[model samples]
Target chain A: MLYEKKEAWSVLLRLYHWAFALSIVCLVVTGLYVHEPWTSTQLEAVRTFPMAYMRYLHFLAGFVFTAALMVRLYLLIFGNRQEKFWNAAPITPSNIVNFFKTILFYLYIGKKDHRLGHNALAFTIYVVVFLLAVCQIITGFYLLYPESVFWQGWGLKLFGTQQQARFLHHIFMWCFMLFAMIHVYLVVWNENVAPEGMISSIFSGDKFVEKS
Target chain B: MSRNLHLSDLNPTLDRRSFLKACTMAAAALGLSSEMVPQIVEAAASPQRPPVVWLHFQECTGCTEALLRASHPDIGRLILDIISLDYHETVMAAAGRQAETCLHDTITKYDGKFVCVVEGAIPTKDGGIYCKIGGRTALSILKEVAPKAAAIIAIGTCATYGGIQAAAPNPTGAVGVNSIIHDKPIVNISGCPPNPINFLGTVLHFLTFKRLPETDSLGRPLFAYGRKIHDHCERRAHFDEGRFVEKFGDEGHKKGYCLYKVGCKGPETYANCPAVRFNDVGVWPVSVGHGCVGCTEPNFWDTMTPFYERLPSVAIPGDRGVVSSAESAGKTILGVAAAAIGVHAAVGIGRRLGKGSSCCAKPAASTQASDDKSKE
Candidate 1:
């Protein structure tokens, strides 16, 4: 079947996606620094290297990610409804059955695509991932909300403590990782199974859909 | 500013010497009387006495013993005199059902006025069948008492996060008070049997401020469990100097060197025990020649084992040690994800290849057999 670009994503969307990728890298590296007990080399670098600067980078990235989320929510509400992000998260009985089929077919479990519908697996993963992303946003703010000096006093007025923020951050980190794992698996599966189909979607914003 | 204003407001008719002399005499009388002299003085000074109700469950009662054995001259009694400890299960005269009734009465009378002290874990296994008080599970009692209390203080490791009894395969399905009562503010005063002064200081801090004191990440009272024991330990000097006692009763140990090498969990433990020694005797685990067991930390039973062994890997959380590409941003996420996906895809493609080959071979075999059968 032939496919065309959906033009669902704006230029801003691409920028946000790339920027989010950049920040994820920063979070993981610095997060490691915070979690691991420091060695002598790390201690020396903490004093000497731009290690302290990385924390600022992480904060800046998080700030940008927060802004992207605000924009994303705005787009979701005000923009076109044809894109099917809502479709990615359908709840009808038929959609639920189809979702399972697509997920299974995509993973090469039961069948590839039984009449162009979702397998239960990927649908569940998509819903879980979206919810997890929402959690990521919640927990990310909980971390950033405490340290913010300007409106940060807002956190004191709101959630109460930085330690609570840290708790939320630590808890959601594992969730984010689990989501990332599943996300990469799906991306690779689509790429290998139908390489041309996978590359065009993000690069040119088109997807593999059957001929109507 | 308020203190200065209050001092200036006092009448100038009384001389300083007479005033001072009167204070000393009153202090002496209060010390000797064993009555409500201190409480009377405090009551007259302030309008009301803060009431505290302490309850025990699934504990060694070491915390109570520690509380009673205060540092100086029995401040526990002084504390009682100051704050009306109207109901205490361990130390009160009442017993069994009557004691339970006293707790209920205090809860009813004070309502949201009294502070609640819990010392032990709440069992949740089999609908909390493991522990029973007055024919009801501890979980039920906690659900009943905790919500109504003004402030709940979980006063030991057991009460804070189900210390030992809640370890793996936990028979009781033990949980902390906070785990159950998410609405009320809980102050965790955790230790195996936390230093009594820590407890006193927390209560005093509350009395002084009319609010709970600052706490650490684990909801621990910061003033008591802020710094690591290893940070200010006496043998810390020896550890810094790289002089360690390798074995118990070894030459280095005999010299009173650092006990870190022999499995001291002090580095990870956070408490004020080193500064404020136990038993008011200037002695603690390390002082008497034993290593720290890290009893205060969460999952200590799992994370801190070989009570004598050192941690194997103490690397920073995400500093991927010798990976091909180690970018300091976002942790080691992409590589781990990429590797996992790569392996999954590799196996998937390999299976697809095998499937294609087998399919083709089977078709060729069937066709050849048909041809041979026709010739025969």
Candidate 2:
């Protein structure tokens, strides 16, 4: 087999992916603490940094996550073809057929369909997850500031009640959690099954794909 | 012809001391200062009773019935005497054309001077044919009555967020008074049957101040619907302690643990129910060992359904079935993922054993290096 090194990801794209991933990690940890503090420590200091600091870090990470998403979306429109969201998506009839074929390959019932970027199914899932991320941002902020003028005036119109918004924020967190689990597993599996160096792609922006 | 007439002398049902006490209590319930009691007493003691037009539409007449059965034994008489109730379908002595005649006459005589109290929801479906008063649809009746009133008070969840009538697949297109009459400064007293004190306080506040009290975005008086029920719940300690009632007859349930696991919407619902208690008996839904249905909230009927579930159920009509609850669905997904990962790992091990050493060694080394890099 002959292998070629392709520039599958730009440095900026890789940076954005890691930044978004790290921020989501921060958010999930802090958000779960905010939801239900499971700490056994009973520090009685006046300047203790317990729940308050967790919340502050969560808010800061939230801003970073939102910024990363915004920048990624902007780059998807204007960046190179490899970085464009549409390159990975390819929602045509052939791509739809390829999506099923890729699924079959995952189940070990079909031949390998190696690519430098995300598969059609993965792209579809990514799109759905991105939409969920958008939902999280909207609902998260609304839940945080239900009493604000902006929330009372416009947020209520966009999302119904604070309860409903909080529900969505929580549901989306689960969605991201679920996605992260599957995504990490699949990436590791792909790397192990086929020496694609999938995990290191985020840091190196390069992958060696074999073509017959 | 004497100018020195006290409220007790005129009413006879309540003595001077009792009347002042009631006034003070009402003022306090309104979240008003002690000084406002004198103003409330003065307003209630005035010679002229403010004419109140009580309109009923698509409703069960619960709000009026609740008021009648208030904690204060003489609350009914006090409310009636304080306000010259021109017309109320459920309580008025007159009926049929005679009652309709009184409503019309009152609307004409005190067009912009009287208070308009609307109970129940207004149906807008089919030209508002769902409810009628004197051959007039609810929409038309409200249109005619609301604009002429000095102030409108939409009492109960029905007249606030269209209540259960406006729930999902709402055939009648029910809506609150605010949706219909946008011109008037309306106050919404939202609950299944809102606390009688809240209604009394709102009325007394209006009577005392000659203006509506400050309201939230939903047009509900801040004094009653300011804090979440969860904040003041008696079982809040249980919630903070992470002790939850998992099921209906479990030890936790019997021991009066937090009902959050059993779908208590109190955390999401904003009302002073826990503080004030229903019927003033120190017993609310939570006190009675049942979760709050969140009836006071907007779209509660649809949004807060599956009353015993922790999270709202996905509404997918017909045979395809529903997505039980958010938490349950999430747990199921997580369980499936865990199982799938376990199976996949087993499969991977089996394949590796069959393939022997050559296929596994290099990939494992590379994957390990990559994992380390990712961690960094």
Q: Highest lDDT, which number?
A: 2
Per-model lDDT = 0.62, 0.77
lDDT accuracy of residue A81 in candidate 2:
50
List, for all models, the DockQ compared with the true complex: 0.02, 0.02
Q: Which lDDT tens digits does candidate 2 get at residues B170-275?
A: 9999999999999988999999998888888898889878999899999999999988887789997566434679998899899898788799998789999998
Docking class of 2: incorrect
Shift of residue B212 alpha carbon in model 2, Å? 0.5
Q: Give me the displacement of residue A88 in model 1, in angstroms.
A: 93
| Local lDDT at B250 for model 2 | 97
Q: For model 2, what is the error of residue A98's alpha carbon versus the real structure, in angstroms, after optimal superposition? A: 82
lDDT digits (tens) for residues B75-142 of candidate 1: 45445645778777777898878888888888899998888899988889899888887788888888
RMSD of 1: 23.1
Question: Which pairs clash (backbone N, Cα, C closer than 3 Å) in model 2?
Answer: none
lDDT of 2 at A67: 63
Candidate 1 retains true contacts at a fraction of 0.00
Can you tell me which runs of candidate 1 are displaced by over 4 Å? Answer: A1-212, B1-47, B70-73, B314-376
